[model samples]
Target: MKSNRMVLVFFILILTLWGCEEEKANKEVKTHGAYTENNVAQKMDKEDKNNEKTAKNQDDNNSVQYFIEEEDFQKFAKKGLNPFGQEKKQINLSSTDFEYYIHGMTHQKVKAKEKWDFFEMHPKRIKWLLEGLEKTKYKLGPDKQKYREILKRWKQKDFSTIVEDHNFIWDENEGTVGKATDRLSQEDEREYLESEYEMMHHFK
Candidate 1:
């Protein structure tokens, strides 16, 4: 009976030790799982913050910075109106205003009997317009480079084929001169101008 009691005690101790080891193993597995899940959550949060920062930076870069007031820019867009007057104030022009000024000059060139008359009559006006364009910050890469080339030409006072250049641009984009006059209605002309403006500057 003593031997039987010793065997029973040994078996019970072995069972107790095995149960303790099993419990410890289960606890370690639970702790490792929790740690892994926390790490994954922290990684996701960091990624979300990085994405938000990138978006905010892009918004700041894309926002337009104007050189002049909105009202003054609109005033410069009026047909047949020259922005540079006899009494010259401090010249402030935006990229949009520069394009509008070009459009007005082109219209004047088309109306004048002598092609070079407008350039001759308003040399100071032309000079101021060019200076304003040089000073203005351009939003589009293509437009900036294009105007730079034109500025180089105009600075040399070489406008021999300006009318041809105007006609070619109009013809290639919209239609022939005859089509513009006879076929295009007033609405069509307005739409064309609006489309052209949007294409050039990516703004309305």
Candidate 2:
């Protein structure tokens, strides 16, 4: 009877060991599968993020919408492009606008190839151009008759139907208007960036 009892105990011990081995093997297989799946998911997520960023940058590079409203341009011209008015009789311009304008237009008069090249490499550089337009200081009597002539040219140059090369240049008008354009300036862009930057800091 004692010998039979010992045999029964041994059988139970063998069964327990087998059960443990099976459990361990199952755990290892499940763990490895889960790890592979996670790796693949992470790679796909990163790829998607990169694609989104690229799309956003492309949009920003071409953000400018061309052509000021013809009526608005005329209104600005009628205002004599001068902030100080005719009574003040003195022209004051910020250094930022004056320096940038000549350099920006220098492409037209001196280096057409270089100007075109600049736009090809970095289109966003022209984002600051509208601002420069707002920065121009109006001198009295640029050419009243000439201003009229340029206005005619601007009206004639509208390319509502055409595509490509729809450039809007300063009308060669001698209006005593305080400014050539009512465009947003670099200062304005800077201010907006700063405001947005400050607003975003808290999220980080």
Worst 10 residues of 2 by lDDT: 113-122
Query: TM-score of each candidate?
Result: 0.32, 0.30
Tens-digit lDDT string for candidate 1 (23-91): 999999999999999999999999999888667545533442322244543465454344442223324
Lowest-sum lDDT 10-residue window in model 1: 112-121
lDDT of 2 by residue, 110-153 (tens): 21221221111112223233233344375424333332332233
lDDT of 2: 0.39
Q: What is the C-alpha lDDT of each candidate?
A: 0.49, 0.39
Pick the lDDT winner.
Answer: 1
Q: TM-score winner among the candidates? A: 1
